[model samples]
Target: MRPTRSVDYRTLAHLRLPPAVSDFIDGGSGDEITLHENTAALRRLRLRPNVLSGTGVPDTSTTVLGTPLATPIAVAPVAYHTLAHPDGETATVRAAGDAGALTVISTFSGQSMEEAARAATGPLWFQLYRFRDRDVTRTLVRRARRAGYAALVLTVDTPVLGRRHRDLRNSFALPPDVRPGNFDADHHTGLRHASPGHSAIARHTTEALEPALGWADVAWLRRITDLPIVLKGVLAPADARRAASEGIDAVIVSNHGGRQLDTTAATIDLLPDVAEAAGGHCEVLFDGGVRDGTDALKALALGARAVMIGRPALWALAAGGGEAVHHLLTLLTEELSDAMALCGRPTLADLDATLLAPATPVCRHTTTARREAP
Candidate 1:
């Protein structure tokens, strides 16, 4: 057998991650209907080129959550970076900082939030998983604020952890050895098997996990922290509208990377209506299946102020550690620039629905109907 050459870190990360972690991050709930749809939605978008529009070296600079980002691409918060590499979130933060992109540190990181924040050279946003424990949630928010985080990303989609079978089949545990560094001491508990009737996964996720979180919580959060709050996991237009009305600084159109709800609407498929409902009321960002620069461009064209990449970053980390993650980000930046020049989009603002032709109609009427109902 030929030994694997030291190819690009991108390729390496893609290969290094264990099947269990891959399935956990990549797999969707029952049937993975939405997981497949996220990628399928991307395939259905056709880019239209505006030739001779004087690209003159396209600029990828754009602002997200009122902070100027070198490019509109941010790394999505994926918990337990240590699963990818020993260095964990620290390595990921370093890579993101070097690439001038933002890294949203997961509340469940292997490295403490402070350490990750200190490691990050670029802007940082702390992703909060509001547990049933309001105190824990509040402590995290306060810590993030003190750490100089630019924003607070409340992942509203996961009131309860979604069905992910890989972890179940793998009988995955946090590997008693690998601890979530940021978790308060009291949060730790003994392991329990995931059973069909009892949603072991949901039960395992932060116990005081607030399922009752609503726009009212957003209002409460605003009073507690001055950091701009961006609500992630919003796929419906009405929810998007409600978020805007509740004074959210931004709305991330995501389906929890297709890990939460199985038959949920694809984030890209739902972007148009959500954006329309948003109507410049808030900055609209996107996540879920954004694998490349072109994918980022396509999302921008559909009205996303920025895009977040999930699995790819972890794959890169797993394959080649921090170096691989850095290389992948560089590749994506270069690719986005190239795509922008080719599409004649001088800036993110230049990308719009005009640059894309619907390759196939993404059926979103059911979600839309739900939004319109009394």
Candidate 2:
């Protein structure tokens, strides 16, 4: 079937990649309660569209940390796009640049930060999970700056990787053809093999990611670089307020796409509170379960300065590489624009809490009489 939307791309991606690889991209953490809630919460939101409000073409443009985006949709940082396509982050970067969307390249990218930045025609941000070696982490930050990346996305949620049962069952390991180009080859040993019932990523994360990382590191990071700092994976309002006070340029209210820990609150449900807690001191971005234009609109109305799509981008990459991703992004923005026009909101400024109607309550059981099982 021809792909017209992100979900369609997901279907194609599922067919294109190997089963284990597909599961790695699609599955969340244990039980996947948060993953389900993220999409379900957005689906339940009710929009109160104004009628004949003289709305015509809707403006979907917005700026993030002084950078102008043609659309408020941005690509979230995820590792190893090469697992989906051999082009890896390079393809995704070029596609996002062409679509006028910002791309956040992961520390675990299949291509080096320099290569991805060189391929990008638009602004780029580097997503860092601070390594145990402060010097090594600093070197990465310097490299990102030297390569023309505009910001730093400090991901704090993943001190250690979560237990994804799908990967565990599959005993997932990276193929010899793919390596996280950002690091030394010796570092890839864990990625190339896995014992039965053990995902290689669990081994890799243990060896590389820092679990003792603390708020002090955040301050230390602030001391070393002038790049705008965006703290991703924040779900608590207290943390948002603290981030604002600590000079964070933005806080991405995310549950790490429900990949880090299961059953965390859905990002959309917590967005408004997080935004409010920031007290207008910093931008509030969002990630998690944003599937379509209406989903994006719901996030903006709730308080996200922008929304990032992770799995959908991977799905697009699998479906075809950079071109498919570009098409998906273009279609998504058009869907957002269409949604805005229908909601009687003509521009980004027209989006606010008032545009959303109170959510209709959903009962746990059926309201009608139940039929006996046949």
Candidate of highest TM-score: 2
TM-score of 2: 0.96
lDDT (Cα, 0-100) at 135 in candidate 1: 78
Q: Per-model C-alpha lDDT, please? A: 0.78, 0.89
Predicted structure with the largest lDDT when compared to the true one? 2
lDDT value, residue 33 of candidate 1: 78
Q: Write the per-residue lDDT of candidate 1 for residues 6-68, one digit (tens) a residue.
A: 124334544666565565555577777787777667756768789989988888887776677
Against the true structure, candidate 2 has what lDDT? 0.89
Error of 2 at 291 (Å): 0.4
Stretches > 4 Å off in candidate 1: 1-15, 191-201, 358-374
Name every residue pair that clashes in candidate 2. none
Error of 1 at 260 (Å): 0.8
Residues 129-179, candidate 2, lDDT per residue (tens digit)? 888888889999999999999999999998999888989999999988889
